[model samples]
Target chain A: MSSWRKLAVAAIAAACIPAALGFAADKGPLRLGTTPTAAQVEGWAIAVRPDGQGLPAGSGSVKDGDELYANVCASCHGTFGEGVGRYPRIAGEGKLTGDRPEQTVQTYWPYATTLFDYINRAMPFPSPHVLPPDQVYAVTAYVLNLNSLVDDDFVADRNTLPKVKMPNREGFNWIDPRPDTHDAACMSNCRPAADVKVSQTAEGKTLTPRTTGPLDTAMPQ
Target chain B: MAEQPKEQLRTAPSSDRRRLLRTGMGAGVAAFAVAASGRARADDPSPPADPDWSQSLGPGIGDRVYGNPSHFEKDVIRRNVPWLTANAESSISFTPLQYQQGIITPSSVFFERYHAGRPTVDPAQHRLMVHGMVDRPLLFTMDDIKRFPSESRIHFIECPANGGMEWRAPQLNSLQYTHGMIGCAEWTGVKLSTIFAQTGLKPGAKWVLAEGADGAHMARSIPLDKMLDDVLLVYAQNGEALRPEQGYPVRLVVPGWQGNVNIKWIRRLQIGDEPWYTREETSKYTELMADGKARGFTWPIYAKSVITFPCPEMPAKGPGIYEIRGLAWSGLGKVKQVDVSLDGGINWTTARLHGPILPKALTKFTMEWRWDGSPALLQSRAMDETGFVQPTLTELRAVRGTNAIYNNNSIQTWQVKPDGSVFNVQLA
Candidate 1:
C-alpha cells in the first residue's frame, strides 16, 4: 500500500501542475524548457562551491602569481594588491574592529575558495573571466601570499585552496538576530525637544555638496 | 486652530503625487504658484489670451509615438555619487525621490545597482539554463518562460546598502544619495515554483544558485524554500517590457529581498544543496558588526521611511500649509501605519496612506502641516503589519554598530531651517 502511495505521488508531480496553478490541466507536465545537452550546461556551470566542488583542474604557485598579477591585475588592484584609486584593497592584515575597518581579503573574507571562485569567474575588470584556470590559480595564490595568509612559495589548486584557513571563517556563523533593536511607537514626551542636536552633517570635509546657498534646483525643468 | 488636514480618501487603485496636486488650491496664476510648489510666482505676469502651445501647431504625433515625460522632467534622471565606486561601470545610481511622487517608481528612472555594467541583452539570444539537482535539466527561452502562467505584482527592490554612507554620519547632502536606492514597480513574470514543477527538484536540492550574464557574472545563493515561495523570473515591468537596466530579457525577482538577490540579466539557475558563497555574498553584502564579526544573510528590509517634501533636494518654500509627503515600505509585510514627526521624532502623528498599500511594496504616506516658519527636524517612522516599528539611528547602530554597511533602515531626519531650507542632518 505504501509503495503504491509513493508511486501515486510521483505520478502527480510528473504530471501537470494543476495544484500549483490553481486550475485543471489535462496536459501531462507543462514541460516548456528544452532538455539541455551536457555541453550546454557545462559551458555555464561557472560557480565554485565552498568545498572547492567546481574548481577547474589546474594549479599555480605564489611565484608565478606575482608575475601574472603585475601583468593583468596591478593596473586596477595596485602592484602589491593594496588597491588603486577607489578599487577595494585586496591584500592586507587590516584590523576589523575600528572606526573604519579596512575590508581586506585576509582580514574580512570568510573562505579562501571564495577568492579563487571570484577570480576565476570575474576578475581583472574590463576583461573579466579571460584568465585561464592556471592563471586564476596563480593569481589566487599570490593574493593569499600578499596577505601573509599563506607561505611565500605556497601553491594553490582544488585540494589546497579549500584547505586554506581564513582568519574570519568562524566569524560569520551568527544567525541574524533581528528585529535586533525594538523601539516602541512612542507618541509624546519621547524626549526633551532641547536634547536634539545636529551631531553631524554632510558638510564634513570632502562630503559637502551644498549647505546655505541657493539649493541646487533639483527641479525637473 | 486650523482644521486638521483632511485625509485624501483614496478609492481608485493608483493615484500619484503629480496628479494629486489639488491639496493646495488658488485661482489662475496664483493656483499655479500654489500647485507648482511655488515654481511660478503668483505675482508673475498674467497669461496672455493664448499661450505659445495653445496658439501654435506643435510637432506631429509621429514625433513621439513611444511617449515620455514632459521636457520639464528631463532633469529628473538617475544621479550617481562618483566617489562611491572605483569605476563608474560597476557602480550604482540613485532615484530622484524628491521629484518622484507616486509609490510606483517609473521604470526609466529606477535606481540602478549593477555589479558589472548593464548589458544590452537580446531576448532572441538569451536563454535561462536550469540544471544541477533537478529531475530534468532544461534550457528556457523567453518564449518558453512566457508560455507558463504569468503573474503581475507590485514590489520594491532596495539595495541592502541603501544608506551605508550615512551610517557614521549624515554624509550625503542630497535625498537621492541618502535614500534613493529603492524603486517600486509592477513586475510581470512566471513564478519560479510553476517552472520548477516542470524541472522537479532533486532529493538534495536545498538551495538554488542564481547566476547572471553580466560581465561580473554576479551570482547569489537563495534558499530553495524561498525560491518556491514567491520568486519570479520577470520579463516585464510597469505594463511594459522591462527597461534594459532592470534586466531586459529576464531577471530574478526574489520578492522582498535585497536588490542583489534579484539578479538582473539572469542566465542560469543551478539548484544545489549548499549556498554558493560567491564574491557578492561573502566578500561583500555581509554586514560587519562592531565586534568585527559580521552577520550573514540579513535579507529583509525593516520598516523604513523619510520625509521627501522637506528633504535636501525638495526643501520647503516659506512653509505655509504644505502637504508633507514621503514613502514608507517593509519587506516583512504591508505597512500598517506611517507616523510623521516635525520635531525629530520627539512626537508622532499618524499620516494618511495615499495609494494602494501592497505587501513588500512602497506605500506613499502624506501629512498636512501648517508650518509657522520655525526650525524643525522632520522625521517619519514606519510600522509594518508585523508590528515592527522603524527604529532611530541610535537604536539601529546600538545593535548593529556603525560598521554595518548593509541593512541601514534607520529613520532619517531632515533639518528644516527657519528660512525653509532643508538639509540632511543626524540628531545627536
Candidate 2:
C-alpha cells in the first residue's frame, strides 16, 4: 500500500513539470508595465519640433523675455546673448568656414527648434528643467530677440515659437559623398625596394651599423 | 637638453652660502696663487659631480605608505578648454590622449563631459524604482542592491560623437579631441536580469526607460531585450565607488551602447510596451542622414581605433627603435587585430595586443618600428571579432554622408615630417 502511494505521488509530480515550464516560457523576455500619466510624465517629455509639434500652450512677450534673461540667462550667456566661457552666445559671430573654426549656435545652429529644445531640456546654471513652460518660451524669445531674429513685441507661444527663422538655417552640410579611394601611390608607388637603412648619430656625427669584435661574456648570469 | 642646465642650477650651493664660499675661495686662491706663482707647479682643475637621488630628502615623507609616478611624469595632466563652454555648468572638456599610454584611462584623469555639469547626489536619498508591466513594482535602495549577486567586468564606454570632428575635413589635428571620448574601467554591479526576475516581467514588454536624478534629468529608452540580456546597475568601477564624473551612487551600465545611454545617477527604470519617445529619442542622438529623413535608434557604436603616439603636434623622437602604440575598441566585442601602416597604407603589420581583450573594452596595441628620418605617413586599422573592419575616412563618408556630424570612426593618418613634427593628413 505504501509503494502504491509513492507511485501515485510520482505520477502527479510528472504531470505538473511540463505545465510549470510552459508557464515560465509563456512570459516573453522583459517584464512589462504601465507608464506614468501625462501630468506625471510631463517632466520627461519636452520635445519641440521645427514645426512646433509638441510646443505647450503658453505665451510670453519679448519684453518679458528680455527682463527674464537679465535676471537669469544673461549672467552666463551675456546681456546681449554673447556667450561667456564655454556657454554658447546667442548673437551671430558670422559664419566661420575655416579649417578650424568655432561652431557656435549663432553662427552654425541649423534650426530655431534646437535652441528651444536645448533650453527646455537643459538650462539654467544650477537647476535644469525646473522652469515652467512659459518661462522657457520667454527665455527662448529673449534669446531670439537678442540674436536680432525676432521683433520686440513678438510673443513666443506654442504657435509663434516654431515660426521663428534662424539666420544660419543652411549652415551645416551633409557628409562627403565619395567611394573608398585607395591611392595607387600606396599600392604600387611605395619607395623602391632598397636595403633597410640603419644609421645612428653619436656626438653630432652619423655612424654606420658595424658589430664590434667579440660578445661580452663577462656579463652577469 | 635644457633640463640638464636647470638641474645643475638647482644643485648649486644656496645663494648666501655660494657668496660666502666665493669670497673665501678668492682669498685662499689668491694666497695660493702668490705661493704657486713663485714655484712652478701643476694641479688638475675639475668640478665636483652632482649628488644622487639619495642625497635629497632620502625618499621623502610618506614614501613607505604610498607611491606615485616618477617626477618626470608631472607634465601629464588632463587638458580642458576654459572658453569653449560658458561657466562650469553644462560644459564638455576633452582628455589629453597624447599624454596617455595604456588603454585604461586613470579615473582621476578621465575626461569629463556633462550636459548640466556634475550633480551632487546624496546616496542615502537615492532610490531605484522599477515599475510598469510587472507583477510587482519594486523600489530598491542602495543597500538593497548590494544584497543581490554581483559581477565585475572591464568595459569601455565611448561617446557616439567621439570622432565627430573628423566627419568633415580633418578638423582638429590631434587624436585627443578625435578619440578622447572613450574610457575603460572594471565595473562591478548587479545584473539587471536579477532585478527583472524579482519584478516578474510580464509578456509583451519591449523597452525600458531609464531616468537620472541630475538637474537635466537625463533619460533614455533602451530595448528590453538588451536590458534583460546584459544590462548592469553598476555601483563601482576600478574597485572603487563610481567616480563622480562617470556616475556616482549608481549608474546604468549599458555595455556597448552610447555613453549618454549609460544614464548616471540612475533613479527610475520603467518597463513599457513601446519606447517613451523622449526628447533624447526623437530629436537628439538621432543621426540626420543626407536624405531628408533622419536615422533614429543608431545605438551600437562601431569599432574604432586611433594611433595616439606620434600624432599631430607630438613629434617622433628621431625615430630609431620606436614603440608604435595606440588604443583599439569596439561596441561589438574584442579587437581581434590592429594593423599598423607606416608607409602610408602600403604594408600592414599586425601589432601586439595587450591586456584582457574583453567584450566592449579598450585593448592596447603596440609595434616596434625603425625610422630613417624620412617623411612617413602612419595609420592604424582595427578589426573587431565581429568581422567588422575599421574603414578609411573616405569609406565612412560613402555610407554616412558628410552632413552627419557624429559616429565618424575612420583610419586617421598622421604625416611625420623629417624633423619629427607630425601633422594630421588624409590619405585617399
Candidate 3:
C-alpha cells in the first residue's frame, strides 16, 4: 500500500472504531450489566444501616449469643471479651480519655446496628459471613450486654437492634475540620535553633529491623 | 491494633534465637554462593579475562514468561511488622520506601492493608452488583464492566493509619514502617459516574457503600459527591491486570481518600440515602481528639512529605554533595511546594518537584545538600495547593492528641549521626 493511501485507511479505521464503540455511551451511560432479579439482589443485600435498614427477619437472645460467642469467637476475642494476643478486646472500662484510651465496644462504638451489621456480614475469623441471621443477632446482643448497653434477656431483631442506644452515641464529631494545622512554608527562623533538639531516638529501643553486620542476626523486636 | 498500645510492640527474641539466626544466615549466604558457581570464579583472572556472561549466551525470553526484578533485588520485598495485627492473613505490610526511586510504587512491593485475609477470587465467578437507591439495579460481570469507557489515572491510595504507630513518638525505626502504607499507581478502569449513570441513581442517593468480596466482606460508606468526582471501578493497575494483593479481578479506587475506603476485590456498590456506618468507618478509621470526642468520616489525607534517602534504612553513605530525595502528596490537591530542612526546622530550602505532578498523586522532590560529616536532623515539609502545610508533631498533638491513631502526617525527622548512620527521631 502507498504511504498516502495507508494514512487515509488508518484514519478511517481509527475514526470508525471509537464512533461505533461510543454510540451507546454518547447517548447516555454504557449500561453493560443485567438488571438483577429480586432473589439475586437479596442474596447480596447484607448491609444493615444506622436507621435499622436492611435487617433480616430473625432474632437472638443474649444467652444464645454468649454460647455462640464462646464457640465461634473465644479463640481470638477471649472468654470475657478481654482480647487475646493482638486481637482487639470487646470489653473496656468505658473510658475514652487517657495516655492510651482503649476504644473497645464499650467505650467507643456508637451504633448497636453496626455491631449486628458487622457480625452478620463478617465474623468468625478465617471464615466470615457463615453465620445465619439468628446467630448473628444473638452474638450482637451478647456483645451489647457485655458493653452494659443491654439487659441479659434483651434480644436483637430488625426492630430492637436499632433502638439500643449506645453510651457514646453523641460522642463523635461528624465533620472533619482539617487544615487543622497552620504550619506555613517559612524559610528562616521557623523555630529557635535550640528547639530542634531530638526529643527521643529509636536507637537504643532495638525496635528497628537490622539490615547488615552482626546486628543483622537480630530478629524483629 | 488488637492489644494495648505498649503490648502491640514486638518483644525482642531470646539471645539463643539470635545465635540460631546468625547460623541460619551464614548457611543462606553459603548456599547463594554455591548456586552462583557458574559465575566467574575469584581465581579466574579479574580484568584480564571476560566474565562468564560474555563467554556464554544468556537465557532466552521463554525462560520466564512473566518477568520479575533481578535476583540481586530479592531483598526488595514488602515486609510486615510482627505485632501489627492478630495474624498475617489480616494485617498490614510496609513497602520498602527507602529502596523506591520514583513516585509509582512497583506492584511487587506495593504496601498491603487487609481487614480480612486476602481472597483468591476467580474472575470468572466474580460479580459486581450495583443496587439500592437506583433507577436500574444491575449486576456486572468482569467482561461487562470492562466494555465501557475506560481511563487510566495515577493516584496514591494511602491508609489513614500510615503513620499511626508514631502518633506519640518515633517508635518505628524505618521510613518503610512509618510511611509505607501508601502506594501510587496507574489505575485503569471505568468511572463510577459512567456506571452510576447506567444504574441511574435515584434522588437522595447521598452515599455509596462499597463492599469487598474478601473473607471480611470489608465495606465503607463514601459520599456521593466524591464518588461522582473521581471514583473508578479499577481492574488494571500499572499497565497489567491488578495484582491479587491489590484486589485482582476488580476493585474500587476512591482516589485521595483513606485506603480503607478503596475497597479491594470489590463486589458491590450500594447506592443509599444515608451512610451505613460500617465497622471500618465507625470502629476503625475514625480519629479521636484530646477532649474525648472522636471524629468520623475523616477522609482527606493532608499534605505530607518525608526524606527517603537519609532515612534509617538508607543512611548517608559518607558526607559529600548528594541529591536528597523524598515524596510529597496531598489528598485534597497538588503538592505545591516541599521544603527540606537539614538542621531540623530551623532552616529550610525549597526542593525541586519532579515526575508527574498530578493532583492526588505522589510527587517526587529532590534537593542538593552537602553533609560535612557533622550530626544533623533531616526533615521535609510539604505544602499543598490548598495552602495546607504539613504540621509538626507538636502542632498535631496540641489539637488531635496522641490517641488519634489515624492521619499522622506530621513532619518526619531523621537524625543523621556523624558516623553516617541514620536513626528515626522526634523533635522536641
Alpha-carbon interface RMSD for all candidates, in angstroms: 7.5, 17.3, 9.5
Task: Give lDDT tens digits, candidate 2, residues B37-124.
Answer: 3332236254234322211222234435645565446545444434333445555556667777776777776777676778888888
Best-to-worst TM-score order: 3, 1, 2
Per-residue CA lDDT of candidate 3, range A48-102, in tens? 8989999999899999998899999888898889898788898756567878788
Q: Candidate 2 chain B: minimum summed lDDT over ten consecutive residues — where?
A: B51-60
Q: TM-score of every model?
A: 0.88, 0.67, 0.89
Ranking by DockQ: 1, 3, 2
Which scores better on TM-score, 1 or 2? 1
Per-residue lDDT of A1-221 in model 2, one digit per residue for the tens?
A: 22222433453343244332122345542333333445544444454556765577787778878788888887777887777654555675653433334344555555666666667766775767677878888888877777677888988887786677765555333321221233221333334435212121121221111112222223221
Please give me the DockQ of candidate 3 compared with the native complex: 0.32
Tell me candidate 2's fraction of native contacts, as a decimal between 0 and 1.
0.08
For residue A122, model 3's alpha carbon misses the true position, in angstroms, by 1.1
Candidate 2 local Cα displacement, residue B12, angstroms: 12
lDDT of 1 by residue, B177-270 (tens): 8988999999999888777778877776778899889888989998776777678999999999988899888999987789999999999999
The DockQ of each candidate is 0.37, 0.07, 0.32
Q: How well is each residue in B1-428 modelled by candidate 3, as lDDT tens digits?
A: 33335333435433433343355533443433333554555586564244333322344446579888978676787876776666778888888888889999999889988778788999999999999998889999999988988989999999998989898778878888889899999999998877876777676677889999998899999877677666899999999999999999999998778898899999999999899988898888898888889999988788899999988888878879989999999987789999999898898999999968988999999999898999988999999887788988989999898899999999999999988889989888
Ranking by lDDT: 3, 1, 2
User: Which parts of model 2 have CA positions greater than 4 angstroms off?
Assistant: A1-121, A132-221, B1-51, B55-68, B82-84, B291-293
Best by lDDT: 3
- Listed per prediction, chain B TM-scores read 0.89, 0.85, 0.89
